[model samples]
Target: MNFLIEENRNLAPYCSMKAGGNAKYLVQPKSVSELCEAVAYFRSRDEKYIVVGNCSNLLFPDSGYDGAVIITCGIRGISYENGVITAHCGDSLSSLARVACENSRAGLEFCYGIPGTVGGGVYMNAGAYGGELSQYFIRGSFIDKNGEIVVIENNDMDFGYRHSRLNYEELILLSAEFSSVEGDRDAVRARMEELMAKRKASQPLEYPSCGSAFKRPAGHYAGALIEQCGLKGTSVGGAQVSVKHAGFVINTGNATATDVTELLSLVSDTVFNETGVRLEPEIRIIK
Candidate 1:
């Protein structure tokens, strides 16, 4: 029992959307052993389960989740030695990037502005400004459904644009090791600052959003397609396609998950109808 289990907990505070129903049960596991214990406990009773990182890319239904919501945010740890950086699943991407910069490492600069955990970034193969996590990733550790720790190499991860093999597996990432080259600390800091400035300038940082709303379609940009369809600033309830960036669907205060879903559907439909190309959501919707 490494986790303190709570009953009927409100989930809104845990998600970036700041709008979600309650969870029948919630567990925050602080370590790998504790995490395994919680998983085993849930499995013994044959209960449904879902693991969450920082909840940056999630939208939980208004009806709430009927099973266990396992939060891994408390399991944080990060270290660097011999040019390899090891980050626990709960370690935030911003923290990791800062650590890299402090060590004068150069590969993780693009991750400086990404608001999520290392586990979440690895799962999504997170990228920005021509740099992706997959480039620096060397290997990772994951706990399988049976509570077995397994190590996987970068090639085995099957990383792609905003996706990885972890999405299909019943495995929980424990930690990851990345390889980075030594660089001038000043240069590294400058690059990170530049990326952060670009994000602040181009994204709707003032509103609540799940970053990019849709995956890039083949032969077309999702935002360009959306803007072409005249869906920018279009609203459904409190949710709206951002006027600043058509690729973002923002919660303009008090937006429900349903509202975001409705807006996403409308945008996808309109874009598909206009461009003959279907857009896929990058945001993960959970119920």
Candidate 2:
């Protein structure tokens, strides 16, 4: 496969939190073909491997991974034709949103500030500010566990709040298509900018975090619950709950995965004790 390969790579620089250890082997596939080839190669060798993009909502263990890490960030592309978008799995959701705005498509403006890739967004049904990827999803293509390509329509995606069929299916996404409405370009851009501004003002953007630490529970916001519990600015080692946004567990400096994990547990336990609600972590922890 024509892909970049590295040995003993530090994973901290890849993830948003910047607090992980290292990977024994890291492979960067530049295209869907390359990705599939690499996957097949790893499978044939019976090597444990994990595919990732952006690493925005993931936490890697300090002890590090002993397997191969395949990064699809190089497999990015976005195209729009007649109000429809076809995006590669590794394409940045934020960049895709900008492309939509440039094409005068309105529906994807909500994705403008999400710090994730199209594959991850689709897998998690990523959403914010009342809009979700499922809302515009039309169809997607992925490689299944058997190394065969499969395509699924929106109806087959089984999308829900922070959930999707990808959770149960052993599939590696390659690309996806989305439907959009024709709209005023200026209005779309304005809405995108407005949402971004709101995020900057309310979120702890200055610090290293995996965005929201916990999922929104029922009708209550995680941030509100955390703040109400007086957990803001709470710290365990170098990890702290952000004062600006109680929902985020931020890395102040030199935080370890253990520190973040411990802090998350503390915050969850404290919140549950006070509110009688158990908070679920939104970040995926890779041990």
What would the per-residue lDDT of candidate 1 be over residues 50-80, giving only the tens digit for each residue?
Answer: 8789999999999999999998888898999
Which predicted model would earn the best TM-score?
2
lDDT of 2 by residue, 1-287 (tens): 57766899999999999999999889998989999989998899998899888999999999888889998888888999988999999999998899999988888999998999999999889999999999999999989999999999999889999999988888899999999998899999999999999999998898899999999999899999999999999999999999998989999988999999999999999999999999999998887
Return the lDDT, model 1, position 287.
54
State model 1's lDDT. Answer: 0.90
Give me the runs in candidate 2 sitting further than 4 Å from their true place: none
